[model samples]
Target: MYRLLIADDEQLEREAIKFIIEESFPGSFTICEAANGLEVVEIALAFKPDLLFLDIKMPGINGLQAAAQINRVLPECRIIIVTAFHYFNYAKEALSLGVVDYITKPAPPEAVVETVKRLIVELESASFKERLAAEREQQLQQITGYFEDDLLVLIAYGEIEAKEIEDYFAILNLQAQTFFAAVATILYPNTPGASILEIEKRVLNKNVVGWVKEYMQKVGRQAYIRSIGAEVFILLLAEENLDEYQARLTGMRLFTELKEALWKEQQIALNIGIGGLCNETGQIGQAFSQAKYALRYEAAPDSIISYGDIERDQQQVFYPYHREKRLYQSILQGDIHASQQLLEDLLTWLREHTSCLEAFQQKVYVGAPRQLTLQIIDCAGSKQMVGPAVDAFAAQNPNIKIDYIIGTSPELPSKIKAQQMAGNVETNVVLTGYDAMGSGLVQQIWERIMPEQKKSFPNLEDNYLPAAKAAFDLFDGYGIVFAWCPGGPMFTYNPDRVKNVPRTTDELLAWCKANPGKFMYPRP
Candidate 1:
């Protein structure tokens, strides 16, 4: 639910705004109010409300001061000015402080409600389908932060407090009899300079969005919608019946509408993964995870892949793990051209090899070993700073996970005397989800702290890494051995254990000796 904080000296005004917001958004928000500026600051910080409504002519610490103080503390909290007169100068100053909009006193509740809705939309826009043009390590850091803060944390996952969470179950226990949830994953292209916010707003406006919204509009029902992973997902619970046929029909219509809107209206291709229904919210995560897994088996001959198909296919699977491993070996041997050509053949083999989408989604089950492949193509002799160009694009991307990935060059103009490495693949520069313009964090680090040292070995290119990314397209988030590592093995087994990282090779070897063949080091 959208959280709002109102700071009005007039108690009636606060109530009026509250009622206006309630009527406009209906059940989409939870609001908190304060009679004074100080109280407003307190509530806003504590609740972490998305929108703040303030009256300019307050008794103590007027609206402007409160806003400045609050803005200093919470840049994300957008302020709306409610003033008695046309304070042009005041509005200008408020805008400077990131006040969303200014309105005349006795503002219509509708107008107040509209402003809050837009801000929520804006927040969602910045995060839709962006990319981070940073190095691999930096991207990982960004991914972790997003998971901890924006993604998992907000949903009340493991130890986080969510009033919405309490209200979620309470409303159902007291009012509804049954619950159900279905998840959908969207796959969109990742590029630099693409505005995730702008694209998302357009996509959300597509009729497909309305189709889903209307499905949940019927009273005595609750539907929760949020963008997870790469797509928009919804949790639906029917109070009385299990219209399985109707639900499937609704999904089909939505899929059709979404496909049409995306292609004709948005000018993009979106692959959707739909899941079988679940009865409980706890089970819904597994359902969503399953759906996400289902998405990995992309490019199915048919659309609308479901969990049931996943079940039937598992019965007679072929090309087991042993065979998949051989394919990965070929890639590590620098047979990239061969792998690219075999893409279609490989997927076809997988389809013929597996029985259902479930087996396809879950690459390995039980004690089966995971398999992966790496393919690297030359950028076709592009100009210098191509990576930074990619970084520049990442800066503007909407759905990017990391904001501050270094993206300039890996060559330092000058080297410090103490520095042992220069003009090498710079060290991992980092960025986080907190940055608004975080594209350059990785590139800068790569050029400065260079990951490569000046080696006396004949094959120098073998040690220099041009780029590295944690490929979601790969198996279970494993590190793909770079193309330059042309050897028999395509993977350098993503160390299963990370509890201890030895600083010295001797220590690592002794640690390995203590454990006996438990570790593998990079070979040049």
Candidate 2:
């Protein structure tokens, strides 16, 4: 229902307008009246009307002044000018202030009713957007809470921005946990106007994230997710062997639902990889290797594959490591016939299984033209040729559907560099391909599976110390920078705002700027 306020210096005019409004738009609106600007302000505050019937001249403050003042307080209120003068200037000013209509005093009942009816449509739109904003804000807050909880896994890149992250963390104190780390790459193809933040916001709406959380909670799993890049993410969570498969499958279903609900016309496909399970919580570094190593298979015959899913039985003498030299020599030696033959064989292998970085590189160097092939030549000229070599690596991971080799990588704006990510939610992550299985980070991460503990908290400082350390390593402690992770919402640390922790420099500055006098001791 629409609420209206009539403010006129003359009591009779106010009464007249009110009666006309009630009669014309009967049961459609609630009416409130005021005699002056000050009274208008008071009534606007108290009554929260959706529209205002304002007289041009009034006692204490003229109609124009009152409308301007009230506009600041009640920006949503639609103004309909009721004045004695039908002067062009009055009409122009009404138009400028965005008044619904400038009707002369003693307006015909029909004119007044028509003006008000128009105002209602606009008021209704504004009201809808306002509700959407409120709901988005509340859901964001809940997402923050989910991430900060110790048992949940989390991954973020740029979507939320930094200040809100600090605010979120201040509200949700980070609870340390021992978990596995994995990344899910969400790919958006030729989506011109679509953005990671929009995707993140849409996912955070009613069903998507909530359903995933509920699914994990019900089955006793833990993970957190943030839209990290244009379409990528690095997720950290705790998982057990049996449950990991279930979690991955369930998350894939949620992803499908999210795309259908939030994405219109855009095709949302995900390449998810699972890092080897870390046996000890202190060895999350190993998971990073597993996660990164899992990235190797962009060329897999199938879309979703895991590090543990492929067979490594073929090669002797570590084909990914040692055979890399032979592969490079095979290409650089400029043996076109040999290179072409090797390439054909490699393509055949790719046709059979998903691509993993090491073997993929070896296959490519022996001569293949997947996008990364060019970067391999560039990196070879300057620096290290050992690990998978490329610039803007995602550019090489082609989405077969588009026939373009571009992976989502997040680039945060200057304004939001400091804010941290949603730190601790139980995120659902799936990675495919890379599998060297490196340092302690990845080792301990996927080793343990988290139990259902949304309502339960664990006390394991020693084990969690490393997982937290690994999370920061992946994305400065804010979260992993996966494509599709929203860019703006980074976390910032403020003693006063214990909820959020800033992840980058700009986010910290923005927070300080927003909070006038708050001092961050570390910065000073």
Candidate 3:
């Protein structure tokens, strides 16, 4: 339902318009009346009408002045000019004030009814568009959160391409030119008399992490916080042109405040370990390791430890960043011998330098041997266009191979599912339409192929159109449609046969009605 205000100096004119509206659009609007433009402005402010009809000639404020004032207050309200005179200047002024319709006094009832109905249609359309835009924004936010979480996991435990990280930063609008990792551990002593269940402990730790994340955001800090263990949360503090000493101080101050807040709110003791600064995002794993090593030196509760304080030469020969990178590269090249040699060297260095060789060996092993061949299944009809680009990408990256598979929408998902169930996932990526995969197929494929919680694609939105990115929303974060070529509903006509072709659906319908059997379109 909508509200409408009709204003005219002549009482008879107002009644005629009101009667026409009541008879034409019953129950559609609740009507209000005003005798002059001043009364129109006053009633409009109090009533907040959806539609307003105003007469031009008035005693005090004119219709144009009242419209300007009403528009300032309620910009969404639709206005109509109801005047006795059909003056060009009045019509122009009404147009400038964004009046939707101009009806002369003693307007035909049909014209008045049609004008009101048209405005209603426009309002409904605008409302629908707003709803769609809001839903799209919400979906994009969810996808963005997933992307950020995936990137953080890769930076902490796995390796990712530098270009891919840059693309992610672009999509997320993060200015993380430099970063350092920190590990926050909750100190909860298990008493001999009181035992806490494992699940309860996990929940408590999660709450603490959430509280810290909220605090960081409230204080306008550029940080990414993720829970990597039962009671351990990893924070990647990022900034532009980061100063090492200043970053360390900032980390210390942040942890201090968090410790105080947690103690006061939940009586929780927290210890934070700060790592060395890393200029490259790829080296975040190294920073994480340093932070973990620093955490070992936190002697007291609610303590803060920096790796630089304990270790004078922070650049140890056994540092896994460079060695692990090399090992990954070697594995990607299918060089078993070089990868084995590097692993052996790293294990030997760990045994000589660290007392906890087993733990360090596990970390090295997790980081070293993950080289995958991505199988891309393109179900869309753009394979012929994108095939050469795929080949060029493969040529550039000699270490990785891409197997581009072209298949129909019906065949690809089932084939991939079969391969997955058989314990062999030949298809690692899929390029298809939004509805290519059947319901629940994406979840099944994701569980089988990426069980380790790896991302299907890094920064998927940065490489595709927003509409195309939205198509992958149904994938449930399992896959992304990186490329799309829209194909449907093409119209063709010969200029000699048809002049002034219709461009819109309504126009086409009208043309068809006028031409009878002469105009034809495909049923589909």
Candidate 4:
């Protein structure tokens, strides 16, 4: 039910309007009455009525003045003007104030009923739109959290393009020119029971994570914190040209405060390790490694350790750059045998020169023959537009291959799934309409792929159109949408039979209503 307010200095006028509403529409409104403009303003503010009716002439303040005040307080309320005279100037002024209806005193029951019905429809539509907007905002916030977590995980262990990072920074409003990684380990009793472990995890996740996030926000810093292990949490501090010494000092101070709080509140102890700052995000893996190494030191309980303090003098390792280049070129030229022979010779040389087996293994793994193949399944029927560019990419990356397949939209999903079930490699990349992704096919395939592979794709926002990128995100990082072309409904009419053909759906609906038997559409 909706709230309604009736305001008039004349008792009979107010009673008449109330009777008309109650009789015309039963149980549709909860009505309130006011004698003058001042009472109208007060009642409207308190009741927050959906619809208001006010007489143009009142004792203290006029209907127009009351309406202005009500509008300022509750702009969503719909207002109607009731007057004894049908003055043109009064109607104009009421219209300027956005009054929904202007009815002269002694309005018929039918006029009042029709006006109320129209306003009800308008109010319902506005309320629905407001709810839909709020829901979309909430969904966007959830998506943002998932995106931030995925980006940080990829940065710490995998390779990502610089352009993708820049795009993410723009979208997230982060001024991340430099960053430093830190790891926090919670110290618990040795061989603790399952219940103890569970309780500690819950406490750390609820209290520590929330406190750190809130503190960073209060200090105007952007930090991404995630639990990377059972008892460890990793934090990436982002800033614009951060001072190295000051950053280390800040990290130590934050860890000290956190340790004190944990002991005082929950009787828990924490040890933190801070890594040296790096300017590029691609080097995050190195920073994480350094932090882990620093954490290996024997430090006092609830203390902070910096990687620089426990330095190591290590022997330098040599890389066969020229040999690796030739090997890659050979593979690009499709000379598999020659590439294999070069790789074997390089491994032998490393084994003979390097005394450390770990060093040799690292070199061999880094220089191994790498290949990536992307299968393009086009459901949008725009293969010709994007095929050549994909071929060019294959040519440039020589080690990578691109295969294109064209199919109708309906058959694409099942075909991909059938191939996966048959132990055959299906399309790793997809170029389909937004409808296909929205239909849940993309999500099905996403469940099968590894998490790391999903994070390997570049930022979708920087690469695709806004609408297309959003469609790809339906999979939440499962698939990459490299191309899209919008398609919509098309209408045709005979010019000879139809005059002034409608150009929009609304106009077409109105036209069809006027000439019902003259319009027809083909069955799908």
lDDT, model 1, position 32: 86
Q: Can you write out model 1's per-residue Cα lDDT over 225-246, one digit (the tens) per residue?
A: 5553345555555555445455
Q: What is the C-alpha RMSD, rounded to one decimal, of candidate 3? A: 19.5
lDDT of 3 by residue, 188-221 (tens): 7668899888787788888887887787788877
lDDT of 3 at 464: 69
Error of 2 at 56 (Å): 46
Q: lDDT for each of the candidates?
A: 0.50, 0.48, 0.69, 0.67
Q: How far is candidate 1 from the true structure (C-alpha RMSD, Å)?
A: 23.7
Q: In candidate 4, residue 161 scores what lDDT?
A: 41
Error of 3 at 86 (Å): 62
Off by over 4 Å in 4: 1-125, 128-132, 159-161, 189-203, 236-240, 298-301, 314-524
Candidate 3 matches the true fold with a TM-score of 0.42
lDDT (tens digit, per residue) of candidate 2 on 1-524: 78888988877577667766776777988888898878987888889888888877667877777777776777666777886543332433344353555776555567787888766665557475576457446655654554453222221222232244444445555333334455555453445786556655455433334544554565555555434433233333443343545644544454344435334533334455555544444334345345545655545522544455555552111122212334554675578887777676656655655545567677658765443222111101223332242334434555321111212111111101112223322312212111111211222222222222213334422334554434425432212212232244334455675556656666655554455335322210
Best by TM-score: 3
Candidate 1 lDDT: 0.50
| Candidate 4 per-residue lDDT over residues 256-362, each given as its tens digit | 67667667866767777776677775555566666766775646776678775564454233345445766876875579998999899789977787676686677
Q: Judge candidate 2 at residue 253 and give its lDDT.
A: 51
- Global CA lDDT of candidate 3, please? 0.69
Model 1 regions lying over 4 Å from their true place: 1-164, 168-178, 185-207, 215-222, 226-230, 241-272, 312-524
Better of 3 and 4 by lDDT: 3
